[model samples]
Target chain A: MSPARLFQGGLVVVAAALAVYPFFGTGYGVRALLQLFMWIALAGSWNLISGLTGYVSFGHVAFFGAGAYTAAILITNAGWSWPLACAAAGVAACGLALLIGYPCLRLKGPYFAIAMLGLNEVLRALVSYFEGLTGGGSGLSLPTLQASVPIYYVMGLCAAAVTALTYVIITSRFGLRLMTIREDEVAAEAMGIDTARHKLYAFLLSAVGPGIVGGLAARDQGYIEPISVFPLATTITMIVMVLFGGKGTVWGPVLGAVILFVSQEVVWARFPYVHQLLFGAIIVAVVLLMPRGVLGILQIKYRLPRTV
Target chain B: MNVVITPAMIAQVVISGLLSGTLYAMVALGLALIFGVMRVINIAHGPMLMLGAYVTFFLYSAFGVNPYLTLPASMAVLFVLGMLLERTLVFRVVDAPELSSLLLTFGISIALVNLAQLAFTSDLRAVEFLTGSFVIGPVAVSKPRIVAFAFAAIITAAAFLFLRNTKLGKAIRATSQSRDVAMVCGINVGRIHLITFGFAAALAAAGGTLIAVIVAIQPEMGQIWTFKSFLVIVLGGAGNYPGALVGGMLLGLIEQLASLFLTTQLSEAVAYVLLVLVLLIRPTGILGGRST
Candidate 1:
């Protein structure tokens, strides 16, 4: 089969599977599926910048936190509608992305990661420090209701839309420039690609899906706290999911999110300690065995040509 | 208007900062060594330090082993762990892209920190060595703090001697300067890399043990230390030992003085501010020569 056909067929199958999942799995399963969808979106968004552009961001939680805080504050204080709040949250997150990326993105390699890490910590500290605004460490709780199911379906659609958008970008001329920059920034710069603009664009694009997902997550949970909203673990999990599934590939992060989340839940339930150990071990093993991730391994085994 | 900063207070801050800075230097030394020799930024450096602290904590708390005695044992175990980690995980990505090495190490760091948290609940653990204080002129410094300082200084000196005088140390240095040339000259670059990684881990372990004695030991303690060490390494410039020492000391002093005036919370931000200033003014660091 042609690559494009295979891609479309896979997406159709995945979408159909998702549509039927809530019914077969029940309410609890549906909730899990919602989480999976959110994570898939987060991981794929992370991949857009870190994986494709080769700029590792240790501070993605900042954007995620921004989205959560924006939505939560608007809904609770201003009494905004959920969809509008989400849109505001996304815009807020994008604004934050621009604020952070404008200065730090100028540095290369681990410097960017360090800057992002600092930014995340600074955000967390600032949020927690301002008790009057962010409710301090106690957290802000929203009203709970049975409206989460529709929200789940909406989130799933958003995840699918974002994934499709990423797919298009990956196959387009912009992606070619991104890949070239990733391969060698100096060479790309020599070839007349404005490295700074490309990186900023990638960073901004990467922040959008996660921002929306973060808003969805806050609404679904009906609460938001600095710790929970800005959890470093979430960012780590997203990066791990992307890498484990196969970075720089369209479907890799989706596959990774599903696999890691399901396995993590199972592991967390049975033996928590062993589960964490295994998580760490898997990262070590994956780095050693398949530095390119699962899709990379598959490509190597099957002699598949590289495709977005 | 005369605002007097007492000599005793200044002495106290200097003493404390030097002790803490020595430990920071020790931790960053290992990081600097590994980065200098292999060009591999071991994000796992902090986790390894945490592991060392935990190992010592367990040995001391569970089996009633003295922390000082268990320190060497922890270092030895960590050395082996580091070697195994490099051989199994890091070796594969040695030739891969820089991002691969970075992401791989970062993954290992996350896994280790989470696993540590899972294994040992997020509670602070410490070993009380000597709590009494001794008077140095008008300033009084804690006995354990002094001892920890002495231990750090001794280790730093020993490390310097080992790297400067030993044949293996010379070989490692030779390899670090030019890997291809070192290989051409019949030096086992792989062996040097392994030893360098192991040595770095050992230094981290020693620092961890001492830190546990000095302060609280928790799973996430390494995260702060990791960033602090990065600031030190960048300030000292990668691969410059003396620079790390000076950088670490300056960082410690800055934090101490800043805390006296600003809140402790702001002290960390101060470090980052200092880092930014250094990066902006002199990216090679204050004492960093062209040797690195």
Candidate 2:
């Protein structure tokens, strides 16, 4: 078999092992699995828009928070089931992407990023203000289920699906259009690509994974707050992870997310207080020393173009 | 929500907002200048201000120096720090793609905030001021607010003049206009960036000195102030110095007015909503704030 086939086989093996790990694994192992899976999902989603399209989204967590909030409200107030609430929340996040993305994506480069940053702040403030619904700053608690086993698998599945979707999107014609747009929006427009529509499509696609995973994670965690769900650190983490992994490539974000997440978990476990400083230092060093990330060292063909 | 807004109440609110807005504009000048010239969205802008505030706070509490007296010292310290950051970190990615710089500055911000947290322990600190509020016509203004506003106005005017009159200021402007053109004209663009970033940091410290008098200071306050500074510049026009001036006041008035009828949180969201609306309607901003 070719290298591609060999890689595919390896993936299949890992997936099978992951599928059965809960049965034999310790509780700690299962917990770590969920955390790693969550980062992969978040990073992959970010990579779709920011890495591939060159539009750095600083407010992607707004969608995650939106999904989490939606599901939380529905499950708690309306007594909806987890599956129905999560699905609806996923739909809500997509709708939000379309609404915010269409107008915001019209902007180019730094403008788009800063605008999105502002959008996240606005969402957090709104969440805090609407005390009755989002439980204000005190936050809402989901009825704790004794089993987080389902959440772990659901997150794993979502991460896998998102990775697969990224591959599909990047290899397709739509992906090329996005790449072209990223290179130069005006040139892409002149070349007959509907830059706006392609960007919007990328934005919408990216929003879904985070939305779904957010719902699952919220249900599993059993309590959610605006501060926890909509952390500015969340947006920064996703960006750094995808960038660290090799943003445009299929395996890059997943690889980056897992490595960074594990490293962070370890570092935080030992040093604890220094994690933020170290994370910040890591980002600064990466931007200064190696903009291409680990995949760059591997001589990957799908590295992001170095166009500011 | 049903708070009746008499004209007197509006006057008082606007007066205080305008006072704070002046100091905000001072802080924003450094931000607008750095981003306008360097394309570096200094995620560390707020933390820089925090540093300035802390610097002044310690100087005031440890010694008997007035807060205003600490402004120049804060500026000097911050300027050196700014110069160091530019030469070391910012200069590397100054010419790279936008993504790298955005994330890099953000990292600097996180590092600085955490450093502050580690050093200062996330406790809220404020400069103690025993000055009393004085009534002016129908509105009352605090003594510190007036003093802060006076400093803000003076610094702003001085910066405006420096940019127009000084040779180095011209070099900075020339570089902001086009780095290549400035280099071609025998101006050291890199050196100008060093100076500009330093000047920007000093201005941030100056603003911090005044802000320390008016508001409570904390480590996490950096992100919101940085974003708010961005909002001000965006509203006024990003590269326009005068735009920062107008935008700061505009933001303050909008927030105060909104709070008159809406919840405090709702009023805060108004800026973000306006930001989106502005981007949709006029990405260049109302003042046509292009880099040139």
- State each model's TM-score restricted to chain B: 0.95, 0.95
Clashing pairs in 1: none
- Model 1 segments more than 4 A misplaced: A1-26, A117-119, A143-146, A265-268, A299-305, B1-12, B62-66, B114-123, B135-140, B272-282, B288-292
Model 2 spans with C-alpha error above 4 angstroms: A300-308, B289-292
lDDT of 2 at B269: 82
Model 1: docking quality category: acceptable
Q: Over the stretch A1-308, how does candidate 2's per-residue lDDT look in tens digits?
A: 96667877999999999999999999999999998998999999999998888888888998899999999999999999898888888898999898788777877767677777777778888989889998999999998676578888888988998898988887888888888887777899999988878888999999988888888878988999988899878887898898787777788889899888888877667986776887788888877777777876575464443321
Give model 1's TM-score versus the native structure. 0.90
Worst 10 residues of 1 chain A by lDDT: A272-281
Question: What are the chain A TM-scores for all the models, listed individually?
Answer: 0.93, 0.94
- TM-score of chain A for candidate 1? 0.93
How far residue A98's Cα lies from its native spot in candidate 2, in Å, is 2.8
Q: Give one digit per residue, the lDDT tens place, for model 1 in A1-308.
A: 98769967987897888787766678888888898888888998998898888888877878889898888888888888888888888888888888767665665656667667667777777777677877878998876656677788879987887788778888889998998889999999999999888998999988888787888888989988888988787887888888899988887898899889998777666776555456566666776777688888888888876664
Going through the candidates in order, the fraction of native interface contacts each one reproduces equals 0.33, 0.80
